[model samples]
Target: MSAGKGLFVSFEGIDGSGKSTQARLLAEALRADGREVVLTREPGGSPGAEEIRALVLQGDPERWSAETELLLFTAARRDHLERTIQPALACGATVICDRFADSTRMYQGLSRGDLRRAVDTLHDLMIGVEPDLTILIDMDPAAALSRAKARATAEERFEDFGIGLQEKMRAGFLALAEEFATRFAVIDGNRAPEAVAEDVLAALKARA
Candidate 1:
């Protein structure tokens, strides 16, 4: 699904998988190629989502449960889609997102263990739009976690996570990518950022 006239390309992986860097690189690459690109992130992009993102990522843990966190993410995604993503797509822009529906399916589903339920909740009632392409950056969880620990400001409710959970999340992402291989491209995020960007561009061209 082109999601309409434009393309919806998303970046997804575990927390420290370098999606932000790749997304920026891809956006720059697209612009350099003379295409209009919009760079955005889930639980963000729009004002409402940004606020919800702060609440979900930074608020007291006591205020949010697994289900609550999932719901907040859904709300942010809905708002982001309606206010930012859809319009950008409709205007014929290539929307490069830092993360999307897959992130929720993997993270929240791993945290809650009901992947089907999470997927159902997000798409069952919507207009039913899926991504055109999903770039999944593959990185070793242990190494990614070490980098995150060294660089993070305050841990999210999920980032205080054990190594086991991070591994589970990584596996979940890979499994989900397998399920949607046609739209999923796994890039080696363990390499240098420049190298990863090159792989990303090549993977995208291959997909195209």
Candidate 2:
């Protein structure tokens, strides 16, 4: 905890699982309550990380090997932690991040290859911090993938992997929640965005 006792929260799930929307809503709700809130996203929070985000998120799915992608993501995360996250926490601001290291654990560690150990090791060594609370929006893979593809954004490299990857990611995320149960909250994301946001707030209150 910081001198001001800031709270760090992160949202994670399969692509298009509405975690981003929930993160945003949570930030808004906190702000409405007069709390200082800092909303950010992984792989692109800081300037250097944003540059790396383009390299990793855009282009072909195979633009980089899984091992390479892991390195790149770790690098971006380090810069994000130093420049964006740490500063906000130091200032006693609630930091609500869209995605974080757990996404890297799924995408490059499990889904892409058997790099779970490597991911953990790198995380412990380079980025030895985890969110005080991690809210995972659980949902059906097909539905989430459909919503993801509907956006048709350039960040579709991972989405382009199709439903198979989405299914794998969903299961992996669920397992991850269990693996880190103490800091993890699983919320059903199959409902409307407002409903999901309500549950997110409830989860935060429970954690508090």
| Estimated TM-score for each candidate | 0.93, 0.98
What local distance difference test score does each model get?
A: 0.83, 0.93
Off by over 4 Å in 2: 1-4
Best by lDDT: 2
Candidate 2 C-alpha lDDT tens digits along 83-183:
99988988888999999999999999999999999999999999988999999999999999999999988899999999999999999999999999999
Give me the displacement of residue 143 in model 2, in angstroms: 0.5
Weakest ten-residue segment in model 2 by summed lDDT: 1-10
- What is residue 161's positional error in candidate 1, in angstroms? 1.5
Off by over 4 Å in 1: 60-63
